[model samples]
Target chain A: DAGITQSPRHKVTETGTPVTLRCHQTENHRYMYWYRQDPGHGLRLIHYSYGVKDTDKGEVSDGYSVSRSKTEDFLLTLESATSSQTSVYFCAIRDSGRGGELFFGEGSRLTVL
Target chain B: GQQVMQIPQYQHVQEGEDFTTYCNSSTTLSNIQWYKQRPGGHPVFLIQLVKSGEVKKQKRLTFQFGEAKKNSSLHITATQTTDVGTYFCAGGPTGAQKLVFGQGTRLTINP
Candidate 1:
């Protein structure tokens, strides 16, 4: 198993509030991703970083922002929480190593009222 | 943006039965990957298929990529009670940095 951990394991915030989720990896992988999972929607990418200060937007990137100032930590923030943004957020990492397996963090469940 | 369509939305089978789900991409994909998420668990990597017409297997599960590189399938034999979860297929284009996951197929196994 890969060493990945997510902070704020669970959170509940009211609408229009700002929330930030943290993702930390012990392996120092070069690639990191943020995704959201909702019922019947599978997982949708929110943002990803290939290296420190190198980030890209994903399909559902609106209303969210990400920053990776270091190799082991990635941060995602929701500017103003909304009911539609309530979902389980996951942090995943993959690098050119050990047969191309993508490891995931336990995930953070967020609920916006 | 890339998209994948997976089906059937949900499936239920008795232990020892067979199960299968498919993923179809709207455009040609450079590679396809599979993931499984147990109840209340995060999505875990299952396998990745990078070549057209490629096939790979692990224990009772088999994965296949279509020759056109726009579709894939996963079949599980002799389903067990532990086979309950959602299976997702993700695809990425060549030189693409992010992966797009399908809607996923939820599986339920009965004893």
Candidate 2:
């Protein structure tokens, strides 16, 4: 149970609509990551931020964008939703002081129609 | 692109039976970590193995890292209903900040 919270725990949006999921953390960890979980595909990294305003794309960053303007909040945005994007999104913070173990949020379930 | 491949997408076993899952990586890994996710819950870290040919045990669960640093396995003894979940193996490549996760193996137990 990390001090991580994901806004909009569950969301359903129509195709081609703009959607954004927010992740907020109080742990003050330097690394934050956005991951999407799909059945049979495990968890795929979408984007990650090492510090304020510092971000990098992951393996499955296509059609998605992320912003980390502050150390406590990281945002993942899907400019136009698609059915293919429907999945459970999870936000995680890495404790670099340790062995880089990740503490994940409860997750946000998004359904695109 | 480093890839971690896990086998046996799903498994069904009766209570008290044993279960195992295997993971292989396309490249050498600096470390390997294991996580378990119960149904409808987020994944939780279980353990990590950093040395080649390393083996660690936690209660009834055992984790092994291959000698080549490119493979790992998790074995659980006497499975129970509480052991039902998806197990994922994530590999951290050398000098990489991110981990590449396998597809995961879902374990279902009949009590």
Candidate 3:
């Protein structure tokens, strides 16, 4: 295990509301990623951080923002939730020790009403 | 942008049957990795293939990478009830930082 934890295991928010999900890791891994999983879409990356204060957008970055002020914490925020944003979000840390393997946190299931 | 496509969006097999899923990419990849997500669970790393025409096996699961590095496959033998879930193949392009994942193949095993 990577000792990763995601806050708010489940959430139900109305469309147009703001929501933020937190990913905290205790392993001190250098790469952290945020992904959303939906039926038929697999897991799509939303954002990722390579180091403190260094972040980049991923394939499905629309309507999502991420921040990493510390090596152990990465946050993903939806400025305004949408019905289409309802999905299970996952946070993962690349295990360089094993070379290219990612250990994922327990996912966060978000529902937009 | 890179795209990884997986086939047979869904599959159902008897407990003792064999099952396989394929993943293809239009562009060549540097390395390919496979992940499995059990129902209601997060994706977990299963294996990573770095060299072309490479084949690796774990217990009852076998993973292979194409000669051109543009495709991959996972085959499971004597499937069991625990095999029910979705299998995803992901790859990163040369010098790319993020991985693109295939749509995945959902497997259902019947008793």
- Each model's Cα RMSD: 1.1, 0.7, 1.0
Which docking class does model 2 fall in?
Answer: high
lDDT of 1 by residue, B3-28 (tens): 79999999999999999999999999
Candidate 3 C-alpha error for residue B97, in Å: 1.5
* Each candidate's DockQ: 0.84, 0.89, 0.87
On residues A25-109, what C-alpha lDDT tens digit does candidate 2 reach at each position? 9999999999999999999999999999999999999999999999999999999999999999999999788998899999999
Q: Sort by DockQ, best first.
A: 2, 3, 1
Stretches of model 2 off by over 4 angstroms after superposition? none
Taking chain B only, the TM-score of every model is 0.98, 0.99, 0.98
Model 3 C-alpha lDDT per residue in residues A2-62, reported as the tens digit of each score: 7999999999999999999999999999899999998888889999998899999998999
Each model's lDDT comes to 0.93, 0.96, 0.93
Tell me the spans in candidate 1 whose CA falls farther than 4 Å from its real position: A97-100
lDDT per residue as tens, model 2, B1-111: 899999889999999999999999999999999999999999999999999999999999999999999999999999989999999999878768788999999999999
lDDT of 3 at B17: 100
Candidate 3, B1-111: lDDT as tens digits = 788999989999999999999999989999999999999888899999999999999999999999999999999999999999999999988766778999999999999
Question: What clash pairs does model 2 have?
Answer: none
